[model samples]
Target: MNKIERIRELVEELNKAAIAYYKYDSPIMTDKQYDDLYDELTSLEKETGYILTGSPTQKVQGDVVDNLEKVDHKYPMLSSNKTKDLDVVRIFISDKDAIQSWKLDGLTVVVEYRNGELYKAVTRGNGTVGEDVTHTFKHCVNLPVRLRKPVDITFRGECVIPWDTFERINFELLEPYSHPRNLAAGTLRQLDANIAIERKLEYYVFDIVDGFDSGNLIGDYAYASDLDMPVVEHCAVRDLGEDFNKFNPENFRLPVDGLIYRYDDTEYGKTLGTTSHHPLNMLALKWQDQLYETTLTDIEWNTSKTGLINPVAIFEPVDLDGAITTRATLHNVSYIEDLELGIGDSIMVYRANMVIPKVHENLTKSNTWELPDKCPCCGGEVKIHNENGSKTLHCCNDGCQAKLLSRLTHYVSKNALNIDGFSEATIEKFMELGWLSSLSDIYTLQDHKNEMKVLDGFGNKSTEKLLTAIEKSKTTTLGRYLYGLSIPLIGRTASKSIGKYFKGDYSKFIEALENAFDFSQLEDFGDTMNMNIHRWYVKYSNVEDAYIPKLLEFDTPKFDSIVDNSSDLSGKVFVVTGSLEHYSNREDLVAVIESLGGKVSGSVSAKTSYLINNDSLSNSSKNKKAKEMDVPIIMEKEFLHLIGN
Candidate 1:
């Protein structure tokens, strides 16, 4: 084979190996085999100057834009004709070799390439027009920024977030997104490309609109995949049911709604034409939800960190997908009313996307469920909160055990008090035993050493360690103590700034509060933050049992005072953006920079000594601005090295 033909073959083999390994967790090539082929491809491309758009060596570029602009598509982005019946799919592909693949559940995107480089990407807004999302599209890790051969081409694909990625993101969030598709769509439309990069969106090319004429749908997919562009997993099949059974959601990575079947012959499909709504060439087989009927046993009211009481429906256990589920969140009071749930009422339940258990329909509709007038955790008065036409229950009592649990959890966290072995569960158990009521009670836990040692999950040694950690926490920095107090608008960064301004002396901080000193004088402390600080201080100080800093000793570190401008970073201005590895967030990094007597700016300018972004190659607005002004752009590790870290 010629060099160009060999390059195409090598690209196809390498991409197939990558898909098998990364997507399926099944490796078809040995590590050495993959590497050797990759090296050979790299050398061949360098020698011939013939790089395919989907080459593995290509660096994907990303850009940040201010907003999404509307664009007209060269081809109308029509949907596929859909049905829930297998018979309909069979009829569509009767006696003809057809291509079948997963009907992916994600944001449909049309990507266009000009001169072998990605030029534009747009969402399927309507049939003829779409919102340009090229900025975020470029951030997609699996998306090819350039295709082999310098030619204009258009392809359609679905930009999807993997189930694991979705779960991981939602796990860290208080109010999680309901579905992966929703998160994917939101991430793709984000004005900042970094959001898409952070989410790690993947695009799988399913159809080609121009440039390549493969004569068949499967041929098109093969050609696209060989070009190094990710293609949807497909197979040539004459029977829909025979191939349908092969798909198991348990083994799949991407969220799929159902299966899609299309005519193999492209020319023959064109003869069938299209409807006003969708193309007749392809038929989408949507999965019918499997539901189980069960009795509604009870409704559990769970209080959140913010004192909101959420309702959870408890029903007779029913097997959904593969797991037995007995409970599902009712969301709020409005949802319960909408479902008209009642004890012992019959209801139908199913897993949405075969993942989240949901109540499909309430058959009985008894409407006997009543709202609780008291808090489930503290027996305190409850009030209905009407937010955006939806009614939610909130615990009115400030000292509700559930609310106290949240505060205590944060108080003993590593970033706050650095208390060891004080898990939220342990704290709750201690609170339940009437050993803890306020922040001061934490120090008093030593009084219950004998009792605590005898408790379950706590031996004499474990109890002693907890007491030691608590005692050691009493000599922490003033910044930590302030953050532990959970003051409104006073986070770790703000608290640290305040602590530094006062020389890490608790007395000076208290004196400033007493004299009504304006907190907005501090860096990054706005008028709203100042108001929140004063309001929180006034309310907290008025409480008779508030946390007393006199019980603890504040650290006076040598570098505690920001007034001393002797650091190497002094007189320098840095602009930090994107995600961080060493620091928790941008605010954390900013605090360190400020502590070293350096200034931080929101934008890159002539005064910017350096722009700190982990993704140095990113074409984000900040990076672009820094380049235009000749400002040095450094990665997190390089910046750390500069500061002697």
Candidate 2:
């Protein structure tokens, strides 16, 4: 292709990849491939002195929407220049003292503090302007609302969701987020601050945009640290090789796209001029991906409990990041269309973040492909539904076996029934053996104890343990039973809300359902959720052979006695971290706090009244945030004393 044509093609490809990665949270191309093409385009722009308006080399910004107010940034958030070449990195540093940190793969946000309180939080949009997200960011996991020093300053950082929170949220979502970055971005832009808070988004300050100056970058970081600001992990590196070896992204809990290197001398670094797209003070280094060629065997459609059918690509086994990889997720119909994927086509695959196998490219673009018209598990009618400009396949049959199996699996999950020994695989085996069909069938497993004992991977002791667990589960609380029902959009938290609202009386819940009571009036409850509960009870209860009533007979539900709401800790939020000395465990401490009319949150925020940690002086993120917010940290004994225990 000619130079101009190549430039156009590169821009189109890179823009598409960026859209997928940033907007959709789904990536069609590997990071290495995109960087290589972007570098080539940069080289062309430099040689010909002709930059296309759409070229990614000029400027790349997040999507601008009308939902949030737009504000101009005091300092333009310029993109960092990146290189995978070690030689280039060496040349840039040139024996100068530098700080190296992870380039967290998430939304870049700038938070301004005025009079020791958070004034504004804005996204990095188009370098010059940004969307105001202060309201939502107030609930960010480690974001301190009040600083120790009454300083007027603006600092830049990345907002992200940790992998654990991402995974837990995805488990309850019908269409899971492709990456934590997208989840964090979507959460930050949410209209409801409660939703953002539930996702547990975190912010790590990286650079002082227009804040208190100490003449040196490291000195500024130390100042910020004294204020207990949550900062990105960084180290002074004299040798690149030693530092790079020590800095492994795999060991980090957060998602990191690359490594960032910045000069420690702030004034000296500022003397170096900047390009239109990037600053000379800092550079990013992305990992080179190792792609493996493989052949597509077939596409498998797995129908989830929500009826959404997901496509999994089965391919010839290839070693990737020390594991044998054979399958990768094709996010949606649009993804398949973009790749033009087909059975028997030559494809390239790679591992993302040294984990999670992904398809990079389809070398053989055989456009001939067919989507299954029937559900693979139950041969039910399949249909396509479009929402938010995305097309997704779904199974029309609600009673499909695949959906039932998924629901059954969730019903017995740890957060639900707390049923031990009955895993999804074991449930599948029981279903295949005709010993299980519905949720009620689980209670009757004792009848098939003999048959199960002789089955594969099961013996007398295993069967006895399973039956004992089932018997013990009959004493579950109302929240567990409600969560176990698998009501649409009703998760553990919502179930707890319902259980507490009705005071854990199954009869009261039934009365509310029969009377068509407005559940939306409750905090955090919506019309859809209310409708879902009503519809579910009506559908299942009217049947003569209903499982709800039968299951209720087995459960001995319990509720907490109403506590005086005038307690000192009432309505206060507490964050518990580290080991406890006075209590048996964290859960015991949380139970006590809840009984005293106080709330327990997984993350620390400005709303928190206290942080309960035995190690009050520990430098954990929660402890740091508590210290920054001026929230008192109390040991277990101190907490108990405050509660008058």
Candidate 3:
């Protein structure tokens, strides 16, 4: 093919390659080849002004993602111009004054507050359309669901879970998370609103997305922290004329694909006109880092407990993003076959999202291919498991290395049954030395005295400590036991309720839970939770087979007070209108109110609660809700008084 055909072919190929790389995690092109083809295409477009119908040059803006609804912003979300040279940043800023701030970690969210209460929270989907996630934001107690005053404003902020929280949760479990950002993102997408509330997700309001300003005010963008608005951090700076050094974009929290430079004067912002796709005044600077290439040594298939096999490319370790990366996830079996990838093949790699180093392009001047016929760890026969056109390779071995300790830990996690002392590190090390095999074998520790001592680090004390910890944990709390059981769809809270409905007896719990399956028998369980309970209970058969007997000793805490199976707030919704006197914060109050079977309202409507209004008289809207619905008007203290603390 000639140059035009070649360019067209390459662009289509690269776009497919990008979709696999970004959208599907099945990368075909190496970074160098993608950059080369992209750069070549750019040069061709610039040289002849012949832009291909679908050239990457025009679409090199952001990663294509899923689980996100494309929502347009009131203001268009634009891509940034990137550079690695700090000197260039200094020059860019020196031309005008600027400020540097610690980039916060988490998800980018747009929240709208109406009449002082939070109206809605949305994800930054495509900078246009976004996913509505007010429910997922239940964890953000720091941000009052209803504001203290009537303020019709749209605020832009990041939804972040602390790195410390992420690490702490993963400390004992095997397969600790790679980063906190992905976890936060996944957590925010959970279907359960109650789960989000329990996750402790925080939102820091940054830019006022929409509000009537007295005048153009950028510096006038007041810090909420100064107002003691439950804020944790803030910063302020002004740009100096072209004399200072360039800024480093890497310094901020929460990973930034780029940075935004806006006029301190909102009026100056209004003055700067817009381009077809971007604003002329507000510039988003992207990061440009150098990349490298390498030859793949091995295609290691790592299977997760969820049964997805991820292809890990083991290559010669080379530095990228300030660290040597020898292994990068090939994503899935389709990724393996799509690239026609094989051992000893040349490929290019680069940091995508500034964190995960991904394979970008393939370099092939000759024909050479190698595919594994057997599992690497157990030498078991492997086969591709496919569903709805998606594929993954699985080791037929029930006891494969991929099913090692980390998998076991996740299987029994608090989400599973929450067995204590079965952390990922300890389990993996035990398995690596051939000390443990199955989940049930974890309870049979004392029988292996000879084997435990033979292991390098193991002595008498460590062995006994493990055994003693296990022994002491016989009577686990209902929630922990249920979550730790590794039952499908049965989380900690769900497990506890199941346990309680059965009077803390394991046998009764198993019988009722299994009977609840079959769909027709399930009235107490919600429709969405139907399949989960069915899959878990049906894993085995017979009343005895379903119940794990003498599995361990355990005890549960009993509630001293009465629990109303029929809730007072069963269908009634409530919105806390002001600062609560009896409850220290909205969260404590929301929890108690919700536990009583009440649905909390975010905005005032015909359906509302006492408003729990401390300033209910001063607040016209709260009063309006009471009048419109003829709802009872009660004070926070009065509500607590009726509850009789």
Candidate 4:
């Protein structure tokens, strides 16, 4: 193809990929392939002296939508000039100290604090106008709703969902998010604050836009830290050569696109000025991905507890990032269709952010691969589910072995039944030996003890420990038992909320479930979650061999120590901040508050009855909110005294 034609084609392809990656939370192409194509487009544009108006290279800001109210930013939200070359970074930081931090791959938000309370949060739309997402951000983990100083300050930060939270959330969804950045963006723009809260979005302050007088970036970070602000992980680097390699994005728990280096001297950075697109003071360095070619051997479909079938690509082993890798996730049917994958096809793969193994390209376009029509584990009818324009495979059978195994594994997990010595692998082995087939089988493991001890990896000592742990687990509380059931949309938090709502009475919880009661009336319970809970109970409650009846035979002591329905603090919201002296830690204090029928919220708001801070006079955001809202600011000792402790 001619240069102009190829450039146009590349532009179209890159724009589609960007839209999929940023707007839809689904990536059709790998980062290496995109970068390679981008480089080719840049070269061709330079050679032809022609650039398309809609070229992806020319875009400075992300996609903007009308889902939320738009407001013009006081300071233009500029992008950072980026390069893959460390030499450019060295030149950019010449003789001055620089602050290097991860360029978090998430939505950029400008949060404004007025009179010590969060006034607004807006996205970076077209660098000038942005969407208002304050309501959604109010539930963001670690984000302060009130400032200690009551200062009117606007700061810039990245709203992100951590990798762990992203994985867990995606694990339950039929159409999983392709990347954390897109998920974070979508979650932040959600009209419902409860959705954002459930997803557990977090904000990390990276820059002070309108508050600080410090001429140094490090000083600004220190000032922000003093206000108990969640700041991005960063370090002062005097030598780029010595420290650049150490600031690897892979080490960060949050998803990061690259590393950012900016001159610490604020005045000098200002003197460098900025372009319409990017500031001259800051430079972003993206890692050059190393792609490896491998032969796809087969596709493995694994069924999850939600019945969603996930595709795993098994390929010839290849060393990647010092580990011998033989497989990578295909994500879903759409991903396979996009790649036109087939067995024995030569495909290119790379480790995303030097961590996740991903298929980048298909060198041989042999589109012979077909999705399984039957469930791989149970040979049941497999159905295709279309959700939000994404296709996913689901096992239609309720008795699918894989689903049962997953549910059983979840039931015995640390956050659920707290059963020790029972790994998923061991459970699978037990299932193979006919020792386990359902959740109730876990309690009756002793019946097969003599046989289990003779199996591989199981001996007298190990079997004894396993049996002891299982016996001990029989004394779990209602919250843990509910969590162990693997109810859809019912995680630890929801289980605890439900447990507390019913005062940890299993019979009351069962009665509510049977009566089809409106569980949304409970705090933090949404319609979808309530529906999931009722559906689960209705499906299994009547079964003669249901796990619930089997589990009820065990001891379930009342959770009286954790909650008291008659306390004066009942239904009141308290925000605890800073160090605590009356309690062992924040968790201990939170437990006490929850037990007293009080709710502990992360952020202070108008509904907050009190702000619990040892230093009540301190200028923290929670204290500021209390002062502004005329809420009581009480010390730990005073709070204890009020509770008659």
The per-model lDDT (C-alpha) reads 0.76, 0.78, 0.57, 0.79
Clash pairs detected, candidate 2:
none
When 1 and 3 are scored with lDDT, the better candidate is: 1
lDDT value, residue 355 of candidate 3: 45
- Give lDDT tens digits, candidate 4, residues 450-557: 988898888999999999888766655667778888887787778878776775567888788778889888765777788888888777756655423344444443
Give the alpha carbon lDDT tens digit for every residue of 32-57 in model 1. Answer: 34545666887799999998765555
Model 3 stretches astray by more than 4 angstroms: 1-214, 219-257, 261-291, 306-308, 352-354, 365-369, 411-421, 428-436, 446-465, 471-539, 542-645
- Taking every candidate in turn, the Cα RMSD to the unseen true structure, in Å, is 17.9, 15.0, 14.5, 15.4
Candidate 2 yields a Cα-based lDDT of 0.78
Predicted candidate 3 versus true structure: per-residue lDDT over 1-645, tens digit per residue = 345545655676677776555343334544444555666776666776766544665544334243433234566554333334455555655554443433454666787767776677777654554556777875675765465557687777778776556657568658654455555666677777776775677777656667545343333345343332344233333542332223443443334444455555566556866644355445444445456788888777666653445678888887765456788777666666666776778888786433446676667523344455777666777787764454667766645666544456864453443445557777888776565665555666778867776666767877777676555445344445555555544554465455444434556555665566343233234444557666555643323431132233323322112133343556766667655554434544565565556767545556565566777566465577576787777777676665553
Clashes per model (N, Cα, C within 3 A): 4, 0, 48, 7
- Report model 2's TM-score to 2 decimal places: 0.51
Residue 565 lDDT (model 2): 35
Q: For model 2, where is the 10-residue window of minimal lDDT?
A: 557-566
lDDT of 2 by residue, 363-410 (tens): 999967798889988898999886444578998776677887888888
Cα misplacement distance, residue 557 of candidate 4 (Å): 7.6
* Candidates sorted on lDDT, descending: 4, 2, 1, 3
Which scores better on lDDT, 1 or 4? 4
